[model samples]
Target chain A: MKSANIQLETLVCPSCTQKIDGALKSLDGIKEDTLKISFATSKVRFDFDEEAVRIEDIEKAINKVGFEVIKSRVK
Target chain B: MQRFIFRNKNKIALINGILIALAFIIRWTAGYMEIFTGLLVAASILGLIPIALQAYQALRVKVVSIDVLVTMAVGGAFAIRNFEESAIVTFLFLFGAYLEQRTLNKTRSAIKALTEMAPETAWKLMDDGEFEEIDIDDVDEGDTLLVKTGAKVPVDGRVLSGEGSINEASITGESIPVAKEAGSGVFAGTLLDNGTLQIVADRVGEDTTFGKIIELVEEAQESKSEAERFIDRFSKYYTPAILLVAILVFLFTRNVELAVTILVLGCPGALVIGVPVSNVAGIGNGASHGVLLKGSEVIRDFSRLDTMIFDKTGTLTQGKPSVAEVQSYGDGIDEARVFLASIERESDHPLALAVLDEIGETDYLEVTDTHVVKGGGITASVGGCRVIVGNQALMTEEGVPLSEQVREDMRRLERSGHSLVLTAVDGELKLLMGIRDPIRPGVADDLESLKKLGVKNLVMLSGDNQGTVDAISSELGLTRAYGHMLPEDKSAYVKDLIGQGEIVAFVGDGVNDSPSLALAHIGIAMGSGTEVAIETSDVVLMNSDFSRLPHALGLVKATSRNMIQNIVIAVGVVLALLASLIFGEWMNMSIGMLVHEGSILVVILNGMRLLRYKLRPSYRLGSRE
Candidate 1:
């Protein structure tokens, strides 16, 4: 699994954080234990299997929850 | 449809806001005309689009969000033909979200600045003897890079040629530009103010100190404090409890409007966001000032520290000792000097450094079987002679008899607050060196400020002799001083202090001080210290400036106070609205929603105050030494 840090546009409140967190956690290739959604910094960090899912899919998940993904980097 | 809604969420909210304003004007001027009602219904549905879509998305993931509650309240109001109330509530909610996004972005600007400072390209030295711009990621370790004036140094490396002043503010948070010559270290993201230099890249990408600092700040911002975690759990149950209470109100009084008002008042918006916002802003403030507080918990713990235990050598003093006097006990003073220089060359202790500096440029001796006697000194076999260089205890342990003349000299040096480093050659007392590390400038004033800032028990822990420790302690006016302490002894002292219900903060900058540093309630490391000390510390003073210590403490205290104020404001606003709705009927749906949104802004603005908190100037002694 590769780690990815996704910076999202400013999260307005805790509810938006929960929605984004839930959306990303439900993805097939995301490592659930590594998922962290920071409302203060509006950053979502998680580990995922590249063969099973791509960063674009994760970005899509967040976008579906009404948040914009600003940038993402894989490490 | 989802993409369109997501892209134009703000515009939709703005349009809805205009429609609501139009509805309000028509109601005021036309006495609730049909056109006003039509505009109200249109604004309600328009604002509800994003909220309803967000609610649906949350439902798909099996989570109930604030949008879900707001959407329900809007839909129920629409079903009852309460067009004005529905329009105002939805418009207010969307407007609140817009303000929140703007303010939250301000709170996060510190990290944003850091992320933007990351250099994207580097001038890699090509094999064809020309510099080519390459992506930073493509610049590998050991690659030579050219850093010109006014360009960010793209990788952490050593200057190979040329000279320049580099501003390392991005890495160390120190704004002053430092001169860099051959063999001097430079980090990525620092700008070379002038002069061109070729650097051999040592650390690149995430491995650079700048990258690590960015990662650390991000992680620190993400980590929740105890108060934040408690609020998270509280909000988890509190939101559902509010829903249940709203349901109970509807069942008991048959007043759907009153029940919806209860839901609007009990959103927990301000309470949930209060603590984390304070944490992020406080950490950001510390980062900009060259202080790296590990996380919210560290700040919380540091704010409560009443007792500060200091490691004597590096923390309070300059940690740089100079050879004051070297007296040879035997006729072979020259021979002892060579052995001392040779043996000290193998060690990096401050006293060893002093010895090396005193005997500048000596021939190397074949020293073997070197070992460190913790807290005492070093043992080695040099030139086939068993030479032991250490303190008085090492001499006594080695059974080297101290002559009366040498003993008198040691007594004088000890009385004068000079640490004695004795050399014993083949069971004979050879030489005695007086090493003294001057107390750091501004320490007395820093300690005085710490006391003023509520540090009650200030103590100094040291492995030096009683005379030296006592002399320094008396000079600094510390509450207590413990001498002749080993690493474990220092840790035990810290544990003892903690056992007495005192929150101890240990400040040190040496390898031996790591145990005590880790044992204290808060470990503060001086930036110039060993890597072990830095890694073991919870807070790092990047410039090793003692004056910054008081400022760091003040920051923590301010942050804690800000957090409490936010909590009171958040909870107090909710209670006020709930009470008004339950008894007086003074707050309708729109009023309650307006007040709820206002409380969120209040708490957020309060947290942002920490970002601008200024530390009081440290008290300076009369002489300014």
Candidate 2:
């Protein structure tokens, strides 16, 4: 089995602008991509295998921790 | 009681009906043609409007509303020689509705307050610069506007160039004026308390912060609390049940006339007006306070929550990192001096800004070859001395070796509940500073009240590392702590707790707390500050204060209790009156009317307990599981 990590370029609450990093990192099979989240502009990428975790699963994982994974169109 | 009766038009309606009924009976007995004619005519004429209005409403609307039932009750009472009773019934019914309207109107002020949120007029550009005179919706983004002292900020934008104290209390609920320099974020609806700012509008209309609040509050589902829903369901059948009982009595007793009396008595007029009147009044009370219970459902759920878990950041702390402590390791340099020099030349992180703000002199340092390395720290040359200011990785990447003590020092700062910044001059570690978000005021006291309310265990969850979460949790005396969490991590933790058989509430600012907030038994959003938080929660605390948690819990408690009292009052008074009418023939029309009127009044006033009720300190946060 192979594993890959992708930085979530903009893992922040679109409303609060707080980083949604550790929250997404806390889920099983998902690992933090060691990237610094830029407030309002940057995303925190995560790396996981497609067979292991889907993007929707990753979103659900992010949601569980009290932070949001906003896809910032502005950025 | 005073607020409820006058605050809502319904109460005023019932009270007016009672007073006029007294006048009608007295004038009828006097029997002077001029006086009786005048009195009867006035009462009948007053009575006709409600009947016509209700009939029109019923024909226009599809449902068999209370208005239709009420209109029929009044007409039937009048047909059977109970003119005063009919007059009072119709008048009270209309009055009760009016009170409900008035109460709702006051509550709608939360939306009206939304209007005051942003400036009504905005600047429009012409061939000659720009002049202020148009609606906010008309003003597009990129329009330049001038905001003066005491003026509400016209739009959400960056300062083209100005400095001032912006009163964000309208949106942020921060009482003190926030000092806004150029580039500091300013929101529309915040008042420019000091200095002038020429801002370019970044967002307008529904996109503006104020517009979003109105949209969110309107979309809030103000469901009836649990206790009220129980009564509401019961009443749906209860009213018809009473009418059937009246019919059965007429069939068995073989007395049509008395059955008519029973029917008139069974109208359940007071019962019908009781609870909603209370609810409308209750909404008044909630608005006067900062808590906005979206619906009766939230109030009901709040009545039952025994355990609550709060997010530590933003909910309990300011969430903005400020420089807390400085430590130095080199000769000829103190902790503050190195921090000042390093941070001055450092990249723009929140920690750097905090340190720079404290030091004040950027002109003192000559920096060359400055660069902010991604995920690493800054590399620069300060005063012919090569300097590297950043986290540990920046130095490690630059081949700067650190002693074991420096690592220990960084660990100590992190354990103390702050992020640590490492600074090295000439490739040797020289400075370390701890940066942290301060605990919000009144947090402990609010938690203490939740304890009194029988909250079993207080849990602190954070995306920050375990060390930071543990330190804050222990400091706050919370029972459990989970750290190094990502957004998805919070929901899983909450689900785990719920799986363990606990009714839990998640209190957060609503931004990062979306999944957990949605999944919890209740989701409480920080008032109006953060958009997503307010948009996606059950309760909106108009003021983002930890102090409000206790008050919100208390309100739900009081409201739930009142709803029960109302249901009992509604059923008890009507059922008792039915028994009295059947068993006690001595009870005449006037006296029967009096008992009915009194019971309705009692139930109504009882419901009003939600209005002026005082909450005494009762429960404390009890630890369990």
Candidate 3:
């Protein structure tokens, strides 16, 4: 498992935050309890299983929810 | 093409807006045109695409969001052949989001400013005595680095040579430049306003104070306050409840238009975003003022605090004491000074430094059999002479005989707020040194300001003698003062205050005060305090300036009041819109959506007020001294 810090381009409203959070949680391999979506900073921090889903897949999932992913760092 | 479309969602919304505007113009000029109806349908469809996609994503995770409600409202309007209402609703929603995105980024600019202040490069001094430019991360501890004029200090270290004026606004939030010379400490992220200096790096990379402040502030902004958590929980039930009500309204009245209007009015957009925005702005304001309120909860608790307890040493008074007078009882006063300075050099007590400071630089004396008595003083043997230096209690324990004149002098000094250290040789009292630590400037005015801010109790606690603590307390006009308190006694006093139903804020700057600091309802650490104190504190005064305390309190009051104002506005708009829909005939789908979007903007603008909050000039009373 690896931790990822992803920055999203300006979450315009709290509803957009809910949409992105929902989309990311439904993706395969994301650790459900580790997900933290900060609407104030437009950043999401989570842990995921690399073997089950790649980092690119997570970004794709966020993009699919109609929000732009600004940058993502893995730790 | 897909990526381009995804990235330019705002531009797509803009184009959809233009289509709606064009459709309205055609209808006004050429009445009842079929092409105008067609254009309206096309604009609504273009706007609904993104909204529908967002709703679909939310549904995949089993969560229904505001986008879902918006999509339903637009689709329901189209089914009813209300092309104008459908086009206007979707366009307004899209445009409102674009405005919100831009404004929310402005609220987050404080953190952006802090991140940008981090120094990226350093001038590392090579072994060959030449400066080489390198990444800050490449610089190691103990490495010598050169900082030129108008450059940022790349690492936290002590100045080795040369001097300069450094603007430490990035670290302490104080705008004024401070003079720096050899042996003076410098921090990373501070700008060297002028001159040049060579420094030895003591702490590098993320270990620097600036790095810690950034990390802490980020974490604090991320943590939710009780009010925020309550709003989140309220929204969890609110959205579903709105859906249930809308469904029941549709089932009973068979009016799809009314049901869709209900859904649009009950979006909870303002209520959900109100609290978090206020918290972010409050934290941002604190960061700019050199006060770090750890989280939203601290602000809530601090604003409500009525009782403040302070530790006397290093907090109410300048912790530095100086020797006021040194009187020798016997011959060889020079020998007495050397013995006292030697033993004091081995001790870390502030009074010991005072004694050494009085007898300037002297030759080292061979000192052996040194022992420190806790809270009393030190005992040592220097050049085969038995020596004891400490307070009256230490002299009494050593069985030293004190003359009548010496006792009179000790009483007068203690009464005048001076701490006396006696040096006894061969079981006879020989030297009496009076040490005085003056009260810090501006303390009196700060106490007055706290009283004005509704602090009912201003108490001082000290381990010093009663006479000294009493004199200092009366000078500061404190409500109460306690002397000769140990660390545990101070903690117990705070606990007693908490038991009495008073919210207490304990302010201190030393390790000994940590227990009391932790026991208080709010722990405030001085910025120049020890590491443990800062870590244990809920709020840190970065420059250790007491004047900021009133400003911090004023901010807390403003933020809490601002949050309440937002809540009332959010809930009020929802109630007014629902009443207009059920009882009046003039309400339409587009007007409802516009009103909802306006309320959201109102609350956001209200929250933004804290970002530019001004501390009243009256609060600066104690700072000048």
* iRMS values for every prediction: 1.3, 22.4, 1.9
What DockQ does each prediction reach against the true complex?
0.78, 0.01, 0.71
State the displacement of the C-alpha of residue A69, model 3, in Å, after optimal TM-score superposition.
2.4
Q: Any runs in candidate 3 off by more than 4 Å, and if so which? A: B1-3, B25-36, B120-209, B323-349, B355-412, B421-434, B529-531, B618-625
Q: What is the lDDT of residue B373 in candidate 1?
A: 97
The DockQ score of candidate 1 comes to: 0.78
Pairs clashing within candidate 1: none
The TM-score that candidate 3 achieves is 0.83
Model 2: how far residue B595 lies from native, Å:
4.4
- Could you give the DockQ of candidate 2? 0.01
Whole-model alpha-carbon lDDT for candidate 1: 0.85
lDDT of 1 by residue, B351-400 (tens): 78788888899798988999999999888998888888998998998899
lDDT comparison, 2 vs 3, better candidate: 3
Error of 2 at B345 (Å): 2.0
Q: Write the per-residue lDDT of candidate 2 for residues B1-625, one digit (tens) a residue.
A: 3223223434445545655755766666765555544454456446545444534433342323344444555555556656656655556445544443344344334344544555877665555886657776567788877778888887888887788898887776777998887777788888888998877888876687766765444333223445545654665565556557656876797654465455445555455545454554455456546666666667767778866878878888888778888777867455335544654644566677776765556455656787778777777766677777777778888888888887787888887888877777777777777888888866776777887776778888888888888888888889888988887888998999889888889998787788999999889887566777666787778778666677778877877777677668767877777787768867544454456556666665666566664456454233310
The lDDT of each candidate is: 0.85, 0.63, 0.85
What would you estimate as the lDDT of candidate 2? 0.63
